[model samples]
Target: MASPESRIIELASRIAANTKKLNDYLVANNLPTPSFDVKGPKANLVPKQEIEVQAARAAIIDDTQELRRLVLGPREYLMSYTHNELISQQAITRFGIAHSFPVGSEASFAEIATKTGLPETNVRQVIRHAINKDIFVEPRPGVVAHNAVSRLLAEDKVIHDWVGASTDDLWQSASQTCNALTKYPGSQEPNETGFALANNTKATVYEVFSQFPERARRFGNAMRSFTEGTGFELSHVVDNFPWGDLPQDGVVVDIGGSQGFVCFALAAQFPSLSFIVQDLEPVIRAAEKQPQAIELGTDRIKFMTHDFLTEQLVHGADVYFFRWILHNWSDKYCVRILRNLIPALKQGAKIVINDNVLPKPGVMSKWQEDRLRSMDLTMTELQNSHERELEDWAELFKLADPRFEFQGGELPKSANLWVLVAEWKGE
Candidate 1:
């Protein structure tokens, strides 16, 4: 049997070959070709064609960098320990769907322009650019198509709810880093300065999402697709997590759980356990509209409107489940959020956090670490947050409630993305 490294090498070689073939096709078919010119100190005196070529090359590099950050970095981090079946599901989310269908397969650029009242040329150019990055596939010249991979983006109620929750919308704000620095010099450090510029007054997540509507849906859908098939992997691990040992039975408030996807999954798996999904009002509406989730039974699983940054409405839940929430805020803010839960928790209440923990050097694959680090940066840039280490999290827990100590035991494998658990103590 070929070693995994050998298989990866083969795959990389195949990807390179296919890239060359695609490039050749673009050249032969009169599509836009990649420019070769590289910018240099002496480029100011260069010819117009060379300058344009250099600019084009630079744009390609920037786009490649962003794509790598999103796909190879964060996506790979989630995929490393996630189930094998979710790869295609996540890949399809590269294209934002209007009604859960791949945007490319739904209609032509002309059709989109007509629907959105945008110019046809602009729409076509945008779609073409996205297609080049494999966000959408063009089966025939000027005619895009969809495959099984695109089905994850289709108009499913569950998919819609999931998409609304996990997407980021600060890419454009982050792009203005240089402009912000040049306009107003500040005493704040570089990272802090950037954070202030991106989101000082507007810490409200929903307001930020509203500002970047399209981007919010895009990021949310991408994450939702990523979690679809991997649900089983998490379910398998969480299902046996000593639920019976809990001191009391109260609501499992899925705090910040938009649309109740996690709650529904857990409730179905453990029928005896009741769940309450607490999120923003918009998300609660979306979750309520999720017919499939409703079929699971409203008695066992329900939705509640709650915001983490503000007051948490839940009280005395046996467990508070936070999946991929704290990573979006700075350590200080995370503590504030966690501290807010203290008043609502009963004695021995458990706090289960599901997020990617960065693996140390030589502990896991380099590719996986690289992905986590990139997400660390992305989260930092967009959300003014950092991915916390175990120690950092322990500190947060202590800050939240001195009475509760971290349950020091055998740590979950670093490979598992959703693999961190902490517990509360009674005085």
Candidate 2:
């Protein structure tokens, strides 16, 4: 086995080579080099579907994370990191610091303080801390300006909402998570969450949001930002699945499908496939009003109020699809949801799920794995639920019913979500 120092050297070489490859790809494609300048690339310019670009990006992420781990060593890394960075981020978002500075324009600390209603001294300290994190930049001494990251927070409402929701809602819940855990050890109830504790309410996160319209809107927009992200695009689902193989005018029931976004994408590609987007009454009403859904023709794609927790209402659909839904519920609840569909499923009917599948220990890149692990914890915090491993998912099907064949899962290239399918084998 190679020494730790030798391993570090190898990782560094890999990082350098991959960085060069990514840079060369960008340059060849006439894209701007990665920079924090306000005028830098508006978005990730590299198409995720490009195989070479994806490989280079993955290499950079894996090697850089490994190199950092090796350099920091185990003990120093574990002990040196602090939640102070999260606090700094919370302060920045809470105070509207990003919104205080105009894009491409610089502002003094005093000016920012006046705009944000924070003390000038506090603004300087907090913003200086944020500057170190590459959120904002102090271009000249005492003058702060929008970097590319900060500019997005100012200009993009969805991204701004994401930051706001993360700092204000998620951070508070995370702070109280330990207390909740201590109070109700091994609890599976959603109302037993830190979110409930933080808000001084026994309601689940969703129930609490239902009472606060503004908070709910911001949370929705925040989720929209995730779906609009590079790998989370609905096009990935449209392209990867063998939807074309289905018979003409086949029915696809989208359980818990919000706003029929995925259905719209599917309708555009597979014109012959019809859809039933089912959700709660409020969600169904809103989904019906979506211009994209209307434009795609309601005749072909219809919205219906149907709760998945109860019995599945629409029977014999070619596919019963669940996108980013099951992870919000505990295994017990997920099994219930699956069992509810049995009465409705025809023999050979498909159940398609698009959601995260946790990697086995030490298998994924540290950078990517950190995100998945965080999501797992987030599920616990919000709903006493979790992201599942592949085995866990297969077991879920088996637990639901023996007749349900766990056809397994596929992680589509350039997509963050896994596509898992099962078929109803029947008695």
**lDDT per model vs. reference:** 0.58, 0.87
Kindly list the per-residue Cα lDDT of model 2 for residues 1-427, writing each as its tens digit. 9887789888888888888988999899888988878888767777867888767887788887767777888998787687775666777778888888678888999999899999999999888888888888887999998888888888888888888899889888888889999998988888998888889889999889999999999999997787777789787688777999988889999999978888988988988999999999998987798888877777789999998889998988899999999999988899999999999989989999999999997786666788899999999888888899999999999999999998887998778999999999994
Q: What is the TM-score of each predicted model, taking all chains together?
A: 0.57, 0.92
Badly placed stretches (over 4 Å) of model 1 are 1-205, 229-233, 247-249, 296-298, 408-416
**In model 2, how large is the Cα lDDT of residue 426?**
98
lDDT, residue 203, model 2? 94
User: At residue 340, what lDDT does model 1 achieve?
Assistant: 81
Cα lDDT of model 1 by residue, 240-323, tens digit: 356656544456888888777777767656667788888889888888878856786677888888788776667777888887
In candidate 1, list every pair of residues with a backbone clash. Answer: 100-153, 100-154, 100-155, 163-220, 167-220
- TM-score attained by model 2: 0.92
lDDT for model 1 comes to: 0.58
The top-ranked prediction according to TM-score is: 2
Which lDDT value does model 2 have at 298? 72
